[model samples]
Target: MAGGMFIFSAVDTQAKFLTDTLHPFQIVWFRQLGLVLGLVFMLSYHGASILRTAAPGLQVLRGAVAAGSATLFIFAVSYVPLADAVAVTFVAPFMVTLMGALILREPVGMRRWTAVIIGFLATLIIIRPGTGAIHPAAFLVILAAALFAVRQIVSRALAGSDNTMTTVAYTALVSVALLSVPLPFVWQWPTEGWQIALLISMALMAALAETLVIKALELAQAVVVAPLHYTILIWSTFYGWLIFGDLPDLWTWVGAAIITATGIYTLNRERLAARKPPQT
Candidate 1:
């Protein structure tokens, strides 16, 4: 999971780099291109059975949410600082906890609820809504985080019936089909050889990152792997400083620390709860 986060951070950094010349939609489309190719290869090897799903509608919904989350995130990062954008998206775990309680009827204890409140407060520190420091685009990342939360909830629902490969395959197919709709309108062909290479690299990295995440999940329990998601902040911070010379402000770091702390606590609580005997 840590390795996957690092790769994803690289993918985000590359997307930010490409945003200099390409639309966010175009970048997202390109990123999904590699996933489509990978899915095609898997289909050829495993046969069409790989795409089979009992919940096709839910899978489609998950794909749409994934597509929206990816596009919104790319668009947000294009305008906002990488670390700041990433920090805002950290709220997804909190959002997931809340959504699970309300939508999935999963019992959320008081401790997790307190952590959720603190996590959102931490996000506000980065957003600074009333202050002039906030960019209008920062809100886009928050929305993207919400969409990501929905994706997570759907993933939990689908996990009982569908295998990981089917979920990944459907996401790739749906996102590619959705993005391909507007791709032609916003598409700007890469002019330079390096730009072409970077686009291909971004696509390949995106697919690799997804595969790594799936493997990581399979290899470990979700609670055990959850904390590794925080590693992206470190990678994002490093890439932001090294590539873009963008350093997060003290408040951003402070806020991120709070969010990360609360997120770990929340995960730990869930882990503990999962081990408890069910109430009769």
Candidate 2:
């Protein structure tokens, strides 16, 4: 979980820096490029065959969903407060609870169900429907989470069919290919040494963050890792404060706390379930 946040934080910092000029789609293209490079390097080191699976459609869907989520997240960051954006993305985990039950046929008890409800509520608090006009960017994030949740669910289903490396490789390849269409309109020369450096760094960090996140998932239960989604906001708050002198309003933190608490409780319950003795 900590590693996942670490990866996402690096990616967020990179995205925040580019939000001023680079269209989110272009930045995501760079990220996809970097991920492809990283995937190539990692596979070379691991000596894994790239096309180890046949789920091309599923792989492409995962990439499209992830790319779209990232584009929306960058949009949200540009308009909404950082913590609020982070809090909104936390909805992915809670949304997953529903997906797991419905699509994967996983059992979710009342306690877990209630936690999912609270997690969804945290998002409502952040958006606060009809409480003055809400930021349109928030809805982008909601859509992102919904798509991302589906992607994660797809990953869960694909796990039995493919190795993680193939999954990452194919997703990056598909995303980079898909994003290639919009490169011409928003393309701008990187005019400064620091700007070039920053883009490169962001790409690297984005890859690092994802690798770490995947590692976190391997080592920890998704339920436990789910709550750690809020920590990205903590990091975002700090980054926004340092970079833009921006502080999240009270409602952001309040909502984030509720989301985090519920996420942790759901994971803890899952952890306990995993610990129980097998039936005779």
For all predicted structures, in order, the TM-scores are 0.96, 0.88
RMSD of 1: 1.3
In model 1, which runs have C-alpha deviations exceeding 4 angstroms?
none
- Model 1 lDDT at residue 155: 73
Best by lDDT: 1
**lDDT tens per residue, model 1, 183-249:** 8899887899988998999999999888777666666656678788898999999999999999999
Top-TM-score structure, candidate number? 1
lDDT of model number 2: 0.77
**Cα RMSD to native, each candidate?**
1.3, 2.5
